[model samples]
Target: MTTTQTFGELDHPSRLLMGPGPINVHPRVLRAMSVQLLGQFDPEFTGYMNETMALYRQVFQTQNRWTFLIDGTSRAAIEAALVSVLAPGDDVVVVNAGRFGLLLSEIAQRCDAKVTTVEGEWGKVVDPQAVEDAVKRVRPRLVACVHGDTSTTMAQPIAAIGEICQRYDALLYVDATATIGGMSTPVDAWRADIVTGGLQKCLGGPSGSGPITISDRAAEHINGRKHVEAGIATAGSVAGNGRRIASNYFDLAMIMDYWSDKRLNHHTEAASMLYAARECARVVLEEGLQARFARHAQAGAAVVAGVEAMGLSVYGDKAHKMTNVTAVVIPPGVDGDRVRARMRTDFEIEIGTAFGPLAGKVWRIGAMGVNARKHAVLTTLAALEAVLRGEGYGFTAGAGVDAALGVFS
Candidate 1:
């Protein structure tokens, strides 16, 4: 059996990835990926990993020693968290606000945990009070929610929920895949015991690695179940006769040791991915995290203001939207895909479309990481205005750009 490669048939796009994730990586981070790969155990590589962990700790705003990268994409971290904390038949309550929330519930169920959902509408956020109420009613052992549901580009409020969970003695985890870097998520202050994110989103890096932070409390629980396999356990490492971890590759206790002074080997960590993660966090710091976040916020707001001025309505509650992503309504009669196609083909720009019920009804525009810039914001807005006009949608000319510019001025 063999495989073949062809370049001619591919629809390679230079999209303005104004969607949920896997946004265009920063040039420096991309360059970091090209550096020579050192052995996973190489002193230099391990040093890089150590520093990378430190950088991510700052990025996540946590002092938790368990903060480290999960080798796969964002979901890997989410699964690791869910499976590690959620014992079989443990009561878990998921705050459901959008597609991502539903996905979280589905994942917890796969772990054999008893899962309950606290519901909200597609574009709306899960109210914290509802979560408190659900905790009181269901009394789950764990509470999980997606901080930003990219499908609707909405940021779920977690501060209150975390407190409520703490009061009820339940674990609180956040899948901050889309909102971590570009938005403000002070993990420790938010009382989030566990938080996970992807490098591809706001970090302006590749999608191969994920960063997760666990509080001291979460780490103690995780380490309690640590149960190092016979082959690797030292005298002090957590050991148990408990059944082997459900997923061999994803067990984080071993990963924590690998990253820690224990220096035990886990599957060869991706040196290049680790390099990229380090550089991605570097970019955020060099640019200044607060400044970078503000840029994403500004650019996103610009797009919303710009497009809304062009007569297209923005989807959902406007007050608490995600800073890095936006969901805009596709005007009546304009084919969403057609407009997106035109944006990519002619304007060299791209945006996202909503999922589930909002599918075909919304256009997702992203302003994140390196993409969150004045030029990107202005260009996307102006291009969108022209594309909408070309689609024969009636709107005031230059109103969108002007509206967006006014914010900065």
Candidate 2:
């Protein structure tokens, strides 16, 4: 006997995604993804790939020729960058500021690198001097850092640390997942050797493709570990002298050839995701980088002002808060989760809860991507005010929206 299961057509309530990331994608990006697919090696498809590389080079604010997308989430490129450059027993120093920082150290350990973690306060950016001290003490082969960590809502100041890495002759790897399109991530200005980002945050797209840019220095090192797969290798293809990278799928050297004019096959590209990524960059560039950044900054400021007016506090060091997300302190005696649930059920909006040490202490609110606008900010603040009031949290009525409007004015 055969059995059949019936499922309803795809439908879900529209939500105001005021969370850390995976926020609402831009309409243009969505439309772009709906375009018909093309063969990975088709001339038209390869042209689109080349265009995407050029677009992300501007997104990363770098002239690096190795700029391209990794066909996975942000973490895939993170793993690829770490594992490719770091051989077994290589020394690497990771600056830990929040949850994602710990992730870096973890990935580096998996790469079999000798990991030295320089811990920083959860809600504050890491001190550049301390990083320099670690570099001097460890003299590691590579220094890894996160540009923006949403868990703490802190944007680490990396220019000084990048210079420190340069002075120490260590390759600098930066994960700019949360800040690339929303803020300035001038790779050359910061002297970052390798940088990776995703589209889910400020880039106004879904998460799948991880955009990466590699300096000549880092690319040369990654190329040193190059090994072509036997199925696709030509007689002229020869493996590099360095240790072979452990993972075949996340190999950057082979990926480079795949993206390069050589057009070597690594894996079939995610066609729809490539469309999304390309359109996302196009949107950012069309908006102009500085203008888009200012919009994010303004939206963040509006949230901060509104929350403060609502008699709540913002988490983390204000001096270094990320422009895309705000961690609002859950007032004493208020059930944070209950408030979040009501915010969803009653208001059709979604905010985030904190993780680890900050769990139950704060709620993260985001005004990013296409949501970084006056109306979205005010609407979220108004809905939040209603939710807080229903939860018996007292504040002057209309204060949140009023304050947010003040920011816009």
Q: What are the per-residue Cα lDDT tens digits for candidate 1 across 49-125?
A: 88988999999998888888999899998998888887667899998988888889898888788899999987788
Best by TM-score: 2
C-alpha TM-score for every candidate: 0.94, 0.97
Estimate candidate 1's alpha-carbon lDDT, on a 0 to 1 scale: 0.85
Over 4 Å off, model 1: 1-13, 230-244
Q: Rate the local accuracy (lDDT) of all candidates.
A: 0.85, 0.92
What lDDT tens digits, residue by residue, belong to model 2 across residues 71-136?
999999899999989988899999998999999999999988899999998999888998999899
Give me candidate 1's TM-score against the actual structure.
0.94
C-alpha RMSD for every candidate: 2.6, 1.9
Best by lDDT: 2
